[model samples]
Target: MSVESKTNAQVMTRVTVIGAVVDGLLGLLKIGVGFVSQSHALVADGVHSLSDLGTDVLVILAAKWSNEEPDANHPYGHDRIETLATLILGSVLLAVAGGIFYDSLQRFFDPSVAIELGIAAFAITVASIVSKEAIYRYTRHYAQLLNSKLLMANAWHSRTDALSSIAVLVGLIGVSFDLIWLDALAALIVAVFIAKIALTLLWDAMQELIDTALPEDQVTAIRAVALDVPGLRDVHHIRTRTMAGKTLMDLHLQVDPRVSVSEGHEIGCWVAASIRAQFQEITDITFHIDPEDDAEMDQEGPTSLRPLRREVLECLRADWGPLVDDAQIRLHYLRGAVDVEVVTSQPVTADVLKSKSRAVWLGRVTVLHPTVGDN
Candidate 1:
């Protein structure tokens, strides 16, 4: 997944390298023993083990490349490299499974395909089972510690090898009783397990590549966290997606319309901080500060079209004349119009108010004068 730290990446690399070495030894030993004993099931299991070497290399490369810092060209970082590697790993498994299945089917139909087994085949299968299982446990422990889904998937892949070896072992026992078909059957079963694991990995990687949203419960929790912030009037338009197990989110945070820009920004920062503190998976957050819900305004009519401050001020100066020049003007763009508030220490009669009413875009204008001190 997101190998944000060099230490985690090193752990992933070391684990995968160890698995690769083990896989190489077991793959060769099993294949050699299968040839000597004429056991197709052991051969199939050996092929599966060999396939792990390829994926182990893939994992090592992915772990290294995916942990790279965001560059000028790749601003989102290299997380997707790990995802792509996973997809490729799945495809490799599927291909290996298909080959094993075809070979097994041929052996099943051709009774001339002699099958034999002995203590060597049994010993190799047992050794593979024990070794692969240990690797699975070791990799899975670090996967959970680092929160790396890719590493965990590899761990399960190792477990599948152990399971397939068990199937092979059962077939070996059947061969001692002169049951030749059981070897082919065990090979077919191993193919099925590999295919199942492949399909699962492929599905998960595809979902991530397509930018699927996080689970509903997690999104709901994020929304709740944002709403809990004291200065937030409302939070909406919350969107979330994951990249290599890290979540990235964006949402709109509504605040008092009259609040200063700095205050609204501060509220957004607090909301982001609270969510980050609660959810460790969230890696990025983008907040859109909103004075009012733009969705609600759209229901009545379109309110997006409005005059800019420069145009509004020019209009005000033209209509209110020199009285607007000396006045402190505040313009609020809401509900398809501008609400102007003029604060000045000058008297304003009905005639002056009526003069500024010519502009249809102006909603209301309130004039205020300085008051004398009473105490």
Candidate 2:
């Protein structure tokens, strides 16, 4: 694969490994403390952290698969694998949140709960806060640096865990005051926050999976780059979308018809290269070249074909120079009609010159080769 793909994979791997290690440790600590202190809220928070471990694993798997090269089955590569994994992770979070909320509601109605506060539960909560906050900052730093939606989602996931830990801390303190309902209330609040984060992640992932167009500002930037090419006359049909962690684009660019095929191809390559150089997110591009007409605007008669023929001759003279000596400009006044011819000193191969000449005449010229001595 490409250097870019390798680098992204390495970064993702590091983040996922860190997430798994930290979350596993935190989950074990919370579960241990929760069981010792008989705190339902603390236990629920532990379960939440445990779920994060699963998400980290999924991230690692998705990053691995999403870096695969394009194939017949997936012409755009496996970028959407990341989106699919994110969707699954979000759904899992929603389910966990729902379960916690259900349990909290049960406690709310039954009110048959034991209030227990201990040093262990409080220490675990504080540790969770510190660890999760640190992970949040670390993950967010890389997320922004990589501009990865998946990493950002994971970072916010860490934030949600931290928020849950804070709720556990509050609940544990309330239990010390003999207010058991506050513990259940805190659990409910934590569940709500998790649900919110899950919904946001789901929405963003769905947008990417459906191939939604990028923001207007980015689309405009792509067009600006394409139009800046030397021979390009106009740009249209510009499109942009996110695939996996990168941007994919396609556009149609107008150029001078007199330019050779290789020159036109070079212009397309330049436009693509410029976009890739300017924007790190752009990973692929395709452009169509359209030729422009100059002399059509110089003529006076309405819909006259003479100006087109004149433009063709001028273009041939500019392109072929002394090789084309005897040239005749012809025109048919019928609707959507054009024809022109150039007589050169030697036999000119059609394969080498046809497209270039036709492009100059807007695909309306006919070149005739006369006897060399007669010409």
Candidate 3:
């Protein structure tokens, strides 16, 4: 099985098992204490915990289905199933938040009812906070280490539960002060927080489902590695995306046109190897090779034309040595002649310099005037 599959299975197993145990026990305790103390807020919070049990089960189901290997029917695999699950979870959160807000609003309008608080309800809320915090930490640590989006979402879910418990604790204290409206108000705030978390998660997961590109920095790092490869002139058309805890990339590589097909292929393989070695996150790479000339032309224009003046100067220096000082070569391509000027340490006749220029030219380059010498 793939690393994603293993991680999903492990996270789901741990989360489901722990969630069932903690939520079950907390739900029972809160309900029992709330009923005896006549605390509606405690009862509502207990119901929320019960709802979490259902959500945890949903997470496990989603993780399992999402980790399935790619099939003919699903060429890209079932990775987006995790995103679908996150969307579902988000919807669930929104609905629950709406329900909680509505109930809290109704309670707010009815000021005649009195809220009762008990020591047992307060203790249960504290215990729930501790337990949920532990779950959040555990899930978040693994989520980051494995880069599992689904697990990270679930971790925040646990964190929201802890926050809700804190709200419950404050409400219970407000009840002691005869502030009956505070309990419902606190629950409403918790509901709003839950809704916000849901919206954020939904938006992020949707981006993933649509196969959004990885961050710019990551793409830049990949491109930098590609350019570092020997024999590679340039890298372009880099594209990257994430799927099931792995990254996939496709890019175009520019290499010398004179290189053979086998050599180009080898260079591409080396580039791919270098990138993967540097960044283990890249699980798949596809490269298209283009001739360096073709690639340059695609970006700008043909770079084949050399500076004739510079070439002539280089030719003079190579053939006649650096004995010629203040040397300059000017090209008049229209006239098919090169103007050469030189200052020699010793006095040299124009005829001797002309002979040297003709020798250096070897017939191709026409020397216009040796009389253009500075000294």
Candidate 4:
């Protein structure tokens, strides 16, 4: 949800504008020529190009909104706006394919329909093929550079249209040779291609909406980065998802039981930065530091070995020889067990610190007293 860099906004704008202009001009020429010459195949291809124009508008809006910094309502930023655009793009492609297919099927059923071809139609159909293919290449190149899923969908969408125009050109040639059924067959093939692209895009976008994990290699790379950091014992519960083509992750990092809290926190920060440096697409990472796994956690609440505070005090006095009345006891309830730290001013021996009777009664015992330099 941080501020989007200027470079991303610039690339998205340039690619979208190029697609809109090229698609608009080509769509108009093909549709006009198709009707004047009574070429249904060219008209169908023209409609496909027009659909590209519609998606270009969606891309523009998605980019604008998604670039906005995180707001009160959308604390994650408007990244999902791009995903929504992708879904809409897929649905529109399917609808266009269905309509074209239905029209082509009708032509097959009706044999007496009049068919005509013109030299001008030939020129426009060839032009559509060349222009659309160029747009596809242009869009695809930038898509790879930006690592943008939405733009890549649009790129393949253009390619489908371009290939469909090739079908149109074949139909025009069929008319010249008096093989009228060829035009209908070509249109049907284009519909299949469009539908295939649509289904793929929809499936990928839906997975993201449901918070699917990244590929195994990507997750493994993240793990490698974290485990390489110093003072980290192990990592677990790693999770990842994408929003606006950027990966977001969260994981639990286990450290030594004796490490200080600040040191653990600093280590977590370093790990996050290291992963991000390796994968520029990773936008955020949340780290939960754990001294050990919570194995015996009770769903109800915190339960101590000695349920009564007085009982715990009596046991502590018996094990440690005697207790100072002013000693402070801090109970940490975790993983269905309590870690007891008794703050004292008296010195205790290592032998007494490792007493087996106390170990048997209390799972974990630690005494916090001043260092040797303290008076």
Candidate 5:
């Protein structure tokens, strides 16, 4: 693993461990006080805090496992593990929300279920609100620094607990004024808040799981960066997908047909470097050097059906008197046709180059005379 990746993992681990410790303490206090004081909202909020502990475990494990270096079995690394864990965390929240909603509705309708609130309940609710809010801010800061979806989800999870505690505080005030049903109503509101955050996390994880493309604006920016590379005629067939928060891309680049193979390869490398410099998230790139644009061509186009270099040379030698030696012949395959060049010391004519039995795949032919060298 790179030093940066290892540092990120360590940061995530430290943040989650701190949050877990706070969650464990607050959950026990809220649940205990809630039962003693008959506050349904407080109990529901306590359950929410405990649920956060479970997701904290998920985040820690994902951070450690996903940061491992790529192995032979998995060449792309294990970033997808974080995505899967995010999905699971969302599912767990959804189930917790449903349970809270059902219990709150039942308590709200029952006439005998009464809430008795005192100074103890109010003090606990206030403490929970302050503690959870602090944890939320801390986690969110690191999440943006690392650009981690899983950490972001956990950060929101902590904020929801703080918001739920606010609802509990309001319910406790109402119970103090002899309003019995307000405690259950507060719990129901907490359930709704949990469900909304859970659904959002679930949707984002699903999009990444299915390999959705990056946004259109980012793709356009990528194309612009690629076109700025020198010696590139055009670029086409740009394909992209996101894994975790990183991008993977492949594209086709067109260059001059007469350029040497080494030159074409150098151009491709320059394009890749330019793109990576512009977009830091793009870690993997594959470029296909093309002599011509073949995006609109069929699968069995002339590029695929064209003869190999050796076959083309044998045909040229048999048909043309000037093409007797392979050393003097050069061939370029472009746009489904072959352009041939022949070099010799003997005198040659345009008619001889053109009047030969031309194959359907041949496009243009040129003859060059050896300079300053006697036979």
Candidate 6:
């Protein structure tokens, strides 16, 4: 889905607020319960939950700032704000994972350590897992529905927390089987999961920040939409970028050479409207209308020959016949040459004369009739 309207801001606000409240309460509950029951794993899990609260703030601020409308200074709107926000969320997760790994490593080396597990720790761990999983599922569902990467990153962050609590629960049960070191191992496992999530988010954001184009299939679809327009002959040089959470494109559109400029512009309007109707993600499109593509245009060199109108008349009169002063000749400066359209005074051979003029100027010339001015 694309950013359809400002109503997305309302949806974002609702989700972030719910997440913040739940995470904060859960962090406090686990920390308080772990300290009372002397479970280091639960305490670390609680700290991770608190750390997620920071990312919640990132989502809120990003959602607010990125929704700003386009302005004179920033004509593209504020979309990249969300991209940078996702980057910061990934960075925070990395720092959190580093802390988890370092603490676990220290505990792994120390020989003298005492841990006491109470029934309350078990209850807290199970509750943490179930609650955090609920949060993850809720956030992830909407993130995919809305196609929001920022929201999706936060969802994974929640998922890691849930998985950490599950590890803690398993480790607590392992200690029952006389495997006490499993408790410490659980922290290391949590660190590994968090690191993977961080790296994935960073890579996705990097791709968007670098202005990557859409996939080939999507580009082909865009071309098809353009070509389907009534007056468009071909579409090429299509490039795409995402701006403010929507697609923007610029492409060259081939049009009939004989069409008037006003007609070409009218065709351009239809092309834009048709594509926008076909692809909801597209917010802006730039159409560069061409009489022909570059390869075909190369055949017409130096459109302007610097021939004055007086020189054209003198050439026509000397080469063909006396020009009736009232004959209409229209010269169009094109590509770098002048195209001629004329109603000739000579009745017998205007087509041959027009063809000769076109060959001389290296441009198109059309004689109105085979009969020229008279029978």
For every model in order, what is the number of clashing pairs? 0, 0, 0, 0, 0, 5
Off by over 4 Å in 5: 31-48, 114-116, 298-304, 373-375
TM-score of each: 0.89, 0.77, 0.72, 0.84, 0.90, 0.81
**Cand. 1 TM to true fold:** 0.89
Tens digits of per-residue lDDT for model 5 on 310-346? 8887777678744557337778887678877776766
**Model 5 steric clash pairs:** none
Give the poorly placed runs of model 6, Cα more than 4 Å off: 1-4, 38-41, 111-116, 295-336, 343-362, 367-375
lDDT of model 5, residue 12: 94
Among these predictions, the greatest lDDT belongs to 5
Error of 6 at 217 (Å): 1.9
Task: Please give, for residues 1-375, the per-residue lDDT of candidate 3 as tens digits.
Answer: 578577767777676677668888888788888888887867877887887888888888877887787899997778777778878877776786687677667768985543457788878889999999998898888778767777778888888889778767777787788787887888789889988988898888887778899999988988898898889998877888777567888888988754768898999999999999998878789998876435435566443444465566667676667743354433332212334444334455556656666432333333333455443
Clashing pairs in 4: none
Hey, what RMSD does candidate 6 come out at?
4.8
What order do you get sorting by TM-score, best first?
Answer: 5, 1, 4, 6, 2, 3
Better of 5 and 6 by TM-score: 5
lDDT digits (tens) for residues 231-319 of candidate 2:
77777777778876788988777676657678988988988888888887888888777654323432443454445545655666676
> Rank order by lDDT, top first?
5, 1, 4, 6, 2, 3
In model 3, the Cα lDDT at residue 133 comes to 91
Q: What overall lDDT, based on C-alpha atoms, would model 4 receive against the true structure? A: 0.77
Q: At residue 82, give the lDDT of candidate 5.
A: 89
Predicted candidate 6 versus true structure: per-residue lDDT over 1-375, tens digit per residue:
245547666677678878888899888988999888777766766786787788898898888888777789878888888889999988888887787677667757862342456788889888888887898899888777767888888888888878767766766786677676776798789988899899998988888899988889999988888888898988777889875357889887878977988898889889899999999889889987777665454347434555767776677666556552545777665565667776655453555765545336535666664353465
- Which runs of model 4 end up more than 4 angstroms from their true locations? 1-4, 31-48, 111-115, 295-335, 342-362, 368-375
Best by TM-score: 5
lDDT of 2: 0.75
